[model samples]
Target: MDTTIRQQAELATAEIAEVAAIPLREPGTELVALEAAPAPVAEAIRKRMDELDMTNTQSIISFGSAAQAELQQISQAMLADVKNKDVGPAGDSLRGIVSTIRGFSVSELDVRRKRSWWEKLTGKAAPFSNFLAKFENVQSQIDKVTDDLLKHEHVLLKDIKSLDMLYEKTLDFYEELGLYISAGEAKLAELDATTIPAKEAAVAALPEDDKMIGSQELRDMRAARDDLERRVHDLKLTRQVTMQSLPSIRLVQENDKSLVTKINSTLVNTVPLWETQLAQAVTIQRSREAAEAVRDANDLTNELLTANAKNLREANAVVRTEMERGVFDIEAVRQANEDLVATINESLQIADEGKARRAEAEKELEHMEKELRETLASAKARDASSDAGASVPTA
Candidate 1:
């Protein structure tokens, strides 16, 4: 009989132990660790929790309620921040800068290549020099503005990324809390369905048989019943706590989801749309400025061409007048003939002097020859008279 009671008590103790272990056997779920969140976000949550008196509270219900309220406030603030931030003016400024750059680029390319005829002739760069100076100034301004815009964009994107991370962390916290609450509720339900019924059956069966009524057996049975009852009470308390926290957890989850949706809309839709529109506006402004510059260049070119045409026409008219009035006549030809006449007169004078000298010399020569012939004749006559006398005597 003792053996049978001992077996029955062992079975009861085993059943009670099993029932008591149900809640403890649940997997642990927890909120997102504060350390995992960004420092600024973590600090903000800490400040909010402090304001709600959550840090010192031992009541899970109170803490959950306070946290939910804080989370809601944070969500609202984030949404307001996003909604109220203004980037339109910055975008307009960027557009203006880009337009100026485009205008300068177009003007530089056009005017530099299309120098006026006067500009080319005089080798003066006044027109293009002024334009280049203005172009450099505008380019510098564009560089500064673009640098500033990039810096601002970087900061804004960083802030947005941080906010997105905070939202995700908040979502994780609420989801984890919800899972914990759910698991707690399931443990309670399981205890009610299985543990409580087994204990009741064991208690009811205790008085059914006299053989089960020994003093030690009854004490053991009573102790087991009391322990089972205590376990049920503890589980009930846990269930109540979890039930009380459920509303707050669900509230936070809903609020977090809403905030996430808003943030995602801004990141994917609103911000992108704004950027696209700004780009289109800048493109349009640039195109308009370029077109205007082109028109101005065309007008300047036409003016230059017209002035060149006028100058060419005046030069052609002068050439025609010079040709028609014999301004190109050969005065040198007449001068050359006058010089030839003077040379011919000098040559004739020289020839006449030579002829006169030659004639005089010829006459002198004839006189000398005649004088020699006369002398010879005299000597011959003398010789002949002498010879005749000698011959008359000697013959």
Candidate 2:
């Protein structure tokens, strides 16, 4: 890692941490009460109870009814925005961007080379340009998305503030409902245990004519108490709704905060790291290409030198041998001279044999002529003797 780049990264991380840090409330100092009420809750209940006289049951009933309406409004207002929101799509988009970044490869940016000698020596710096163009394109997408995320962050921050206000108001309504319910229960208990019983006794003691009026008054008081009980029940139900809203508001706010922090981290840290790593990858790739070219050149040079040396050795050997030799070798001349002498001897022997055969044929012809002349003479003598005998006698 470069010193400057490392420092910049450290600085970016620090900035992200500082910017994203949130101030937290101390443990057990929560404002919303779920189970147990504190001193303030007790005081609020007592004060609400003091506002209504037990004899005026109508007033107590009115108080609970009003509280019920108010709590319902608070709960509805707090949950209005919560019901329509979903954070899933935003998370999906972020994940897709992260996947795209993860899928990036330095190999994709490499220029394909034919690796011929000329191409190696005069190769353009296309790899660097290719890497730069691709990096810029990726960075551009990230920048556009980050810009959108920043806008979303601002909107989410505003929403957190809005939810905070709604949460506080909901808590107030919860406590108010508690006050209404507690006071209504106390008034109901008093009427059931003491007031109603006493009224019944007073009516029973009245004379026949006055009993009807006292009984009617007792019935109205009982009706008022029942109405108050129903109102208190409604108030408690609204309070339950408010109770549920508190956590929902908090959950939405926390989700927005988490997304904001993630956006900040991407802007400050992850993007810069990508740039740094990509540059390093390109640099390393170029160095490798250069080293390969040098190695190939050395190997080619070695092969050419080896081939030339072998050709030179063969040419030199042939030329030197030709330069040292006679035009006609003595061995070839001696073999041809011996072949000519053998041909002369064979011709003389053939001529002598032909002359001896001619002389023998001439002697044989002279002897054959002499034998023919003697045979002719003997035949002539026989013919002459036969002729003489024929002329002399027939015996």
Instruction: Show model 1 residue runs off by greater than 4 Å.
Output: 1-67, 73-97, 107-130, 180-395
What are the lDDT scores of the predictions, listed in order? 0.51, 0.69
> Compared with the true structure, what per-residue lDDT tens digits does model 1 show for residues 324-386?
875445787788889999999999999999999999999999999999999999999998898
TM-score of each: 0.27, 0.56
Model 2 scores worst on lDDT over the 10 consecutive residues at 25-34
Clash statistics: count for each candidate: 0, 0
Can you list the residue pairs that collide in candidate 1?
none
Question: Number of the top candidate by TM-score?
Answer: 2
Candidate 1 achieves a global lDDT of 0.51
